[model samples]
Target: MTELNFPALGRQPTGCPPARGVLVCWLAADGSQVHVGDRLAEVRVADDRFGRRIGWVSALATGTLWHQVRAGEVLTAGAVVGLID
Candidate 1:
């Protein structure tokens, strides 16, 4: 079985409308293969005042994108945006 992990340990965002923005700019474009430690998505969050917040998520293991994500989207903590097979 493949194991998934956080690319970097940081404050995980919670709640609704003011979700953290997710961008897949630093990794392969959607539909490309990747490996563990490879940049998956770069997240820029907003502080209570909606300022700049930062974090990144990388491939936890080598796999294909069972699904794809886009840039400038919002995500909640522990949301599985992609599936690796």
Candidate 2:
């Protein structure tokens, strides 16, 4: 099985802190088949200057999706969001 992790969004401009975000929603359903680059979920990131911004999380492999995180959950860089098997 392959893990689907929340991707790092780089550093903040002011203090160079890592970006933190929340899981907005899942675009792909659990147990659904997905391919590489498929949109898996939506995330809302807290930006210092830009406020909150929405982002899409994509699948890294082709397999059945199993969610490890739920909507509205807090997220950090490299957090395990799901699994593909």
Residue-by-residue lDDT tens digits, candidate 1, 4-85: 3223224445543334455545455556788887766676655565466677776777877544455665565556666567
Models 1 onward score TM values of 0.61, 0.86
- Mark the regions of model 2 whose C-alpha exceeds 4 Å error after superposition: 13-17
Ten consecutive residues with minimal summed lDDT in candidate 2? 8-17
Name the best candidate (by TM-score): 2
Q: Once superposed on the true structure, which residue ranges of model 1 sit more than 4 Å away at CA?
A: 1-19, 24-26
Q: For candidate 2, lDDT tens digit of each residue in 32-55?
A: 999999999998888777787888
How does model 1 score by TM-score? 0.61
In candidate 2, residue 47 scores what lDDT?
73
User: Which ten contiguous residues of candidate 1 have the minimum total lDDT?
Assistant: 1-10
Alpha-carbon RMSD of each model:
4.3, 1.9
- Candidate 2 residue pairs in clash (backbone atoms < 3 Å): none
Write down the lDDT that model 1 would get. 0.57
lDDT of 1 at 16: 37
